[model samples]
Target: MEIRLRVESAVRDEAEELTSALHDWLREDRDVGRHARIGRLADSGGAPSGAMSADWFGWVQLIAGSGFSTAGLVYAHNAFRASLPRRQQTVSVVIEHNGTRIVLEDASPESAARIAEILSGSGDDEEAPGGSS
Candidate 1:
């Protein structure tokens, strides 16, 4: 599988930083192919400050194929949040595959696990995006 991650941020610098961090994690920890491409979506003036809104700012998309598994994407997101200070940071991750899109918001471990399960097709719940559990 070819997995591509695109991060969009109101802050171009922050988005770029996230892209770099994702690339490093995927490469070093997940053993992703060095050629796997991870990109940063240019800021288009629509990024939510305290919430995960794709309205104006930026978001990240991960596309993976044969050599990559959905689990890798989940792991990367978890790792990313783990490295950050929780009280000041919030991350929203969305995974799209085969027409199925699963979104996970907040920096909680449970959310990450839910995202993984959703992506893996083990989760049968259909909750609104960014909605409470």
Candidate 2:
């Protein structure tokens, strides 16, 4: 299954920076990296800021293969948040699966669990381009 993720911050620069940071951070995860990847270079359309990019901005393509754990994904997110400084910790991370969205801010375990649950489900919602029904 795959989900689209984005980082949002009060400042555009922070959002862009955090988006790249989280992407790199996810790639370092043994479990997640094995099954997930960010936008493909061919899908990329360069712009002033990656966060503000017109194509594939801040999107994560997660493939929950055998041995893939939703908890691991959530844990990685929580850990990433915990790794940030207090001020930047408030930056928001959004995960979207089958129309369900889980926003991570304080990296609460409850939120992590909720995201895990979402990711663990049968994620067959193949959104159309522009997200039209």
Candidate 3:
């Protein structure tokens, strides 16, 4: 199975930087790197601050294979967040499935875990995206 994630940040420069960070992480993680890869280069159209772009200002494509685990991704995200100072950063994630896209932002812990389980294709609960436990 494959999972595609679209990541975005409120600040254009931050968006670009985060996209690169995510891509590098996925590529360098031993376990995840064995089964997953960055599907494509992050799409951050070069322009001035207010330039129009695709659905999101920045994007990340997370392609997970059989060996990849949702927990790892979550852990990586948490680690990344921990390294940053406490501040209100608007980072959004969108998952695409069967042509439908689900946007996730500021989700509760339960909802975030549930979404991860769903995306990892390891959940049997059949809960909708962003659903809390």
Candidate 4:
């Protein structure tokens, strides 16, 4: 699955750096490293498309492959959040996966995992009694 993660910051200039930081952080994960990459959105002159901000630099794209699990992506994201200082605060995060958009503003581990399960379609089986599919 392809996941687009954008770090929203009040400082427009900081957005790009923050996104790159996330990409680097994700690479530290053995499983998520190779699959994670920084993605760029092409600019159309001075005005950007209605779909996104013109000033928006880009975001980190995490494509989970056979070697990595969706859970790893969640782990990397949370870890990155924990690494941030107060000065480098991120307003929020918009994650788009398979047309399912999830906006997170300081979500807890449980909440994050539950979201991952939901997005990966793993919650259904786990929710079933005796783990039946």
Candidate 5:
């Protein structure tokens, strides 16, 4: 369960702030683990081989244990969004396991947070139908 958050295209100051916030959050939770800055796309000299400015836009990665459910992943995303400021910005989050990938995006952090919460079951806990927990 290695969680790595790599923030790219972020202004130096903003990136620093984001990194610090992530550290604090991860520290408070035992489920969350190590945080590392593998590399930054902006500092990669030129654009990545196949990543476009639009396609390879800024992103953050959370490497967690294998047993983590998708719901948990969604919860983490929502938590990250909640920590951000209210501003107009496009964000794309990709969670990769083995060779598979799950992507989530939003034009605004608030919307992303809402969607993540719904998917994560951290939102309204009302039962959905047939007495399913």
Candidate 6:
């Protein structure tokens, strides 16, 4: 499984700071460890993006191995949210698993919690006594 959170920052420096914070958070994760790969997003001009007044400079990409549980993902996301200032950050989450892709835009705590429940198969599974899957 691969998870990537792409957030837009106001400026290039903020983007760099966000990247650093994300790296620190991931490293702190017991599953992600300290072997995650980080990189920046580029534009069609082949130059690093997110440099314009409202361009795409606030972009950071992270690559990590699988072994991360749903609960762990939620924890990581929460930690990431707490690590940054309450700036107007627009975030998108992408998860690739077994060739299938899942994308979530403007992911919030509620959405993360729901995703955790779904991934962990902890959602409402109780049947009406006679119901079936």
How many clashing residue pairs appear in each of the predictions shown?
13, 0, 0, 0, 3, 3
**lDDT of all the models against the reference?**
0.51, 0.64, 0.56, 0.61, 0.41, 0.48
Better of 2 and 3 by TM-score: 2
lDDT of 2 by residue, 1-133 (tens): 6776667675556766777788888888887887765452212434333345545444555655676777778788888888888888877676777776666656765666657656766333442212121
Candidate with best TM-score: 2
Q: Which residue pairs show backbone clashes in model 4?
A: none
| Per-residue lDDT of model 6, residues 5-73, tens digit only | 443343566555565566566667775554345455442232224465444433344565455567666
Model 4 per-residue lDDT tens digits across residues 1-133: 6777666665555666777787678777776887555455432223212334565556677766666667777777677787889665444665666655555666466647655765675554232211122
Query: What TM-score fits each model?
Result: 0.52, 0.73, 0.63, 0.69, 0.42, 0.50
Q: Which pairs clash inside model 6?
A: 49-57, 50-56, 50-57
lDDT of 1 by residue, 1-133 (tens): 3223433345555655655665566656553434245544433445434434444324333444456655555666767767766642454445544444455555465766666666566654554344334
Candidate structures ordered by TM-score, highest first: 2, 4, 3, 1, 6, 5
Off by over 4 Å in 3: 41-49, 55-57, 88-90, 97-100, 106-108, 120-133
In candidate 2, the residue pairs with backbone N, CA or C atoms under 3 Å apart (3 or more residues apart, or in different chains) clash, namely none
RMSD of each: 5.4, 6.1, 4.9, 7.3, 9.9, 9.0
Q: What pairs collide in candidate 5?
A: 1-65, 2-63, 3-63
lDDT of 5 by residue, 1-133 (tens): 3333433223544544454554456545444443322232222333323443342323334444555444444455467656677651233333333332333444244434543444344544442221121
Kindly list the per-residue Cα lDDT of model 3 for residues 1-133, writing each as its tens digit.
5655544555666666666676676677676677776655435444325536544435557677777877776666555545444563336555554444555454457546655666745555432444433
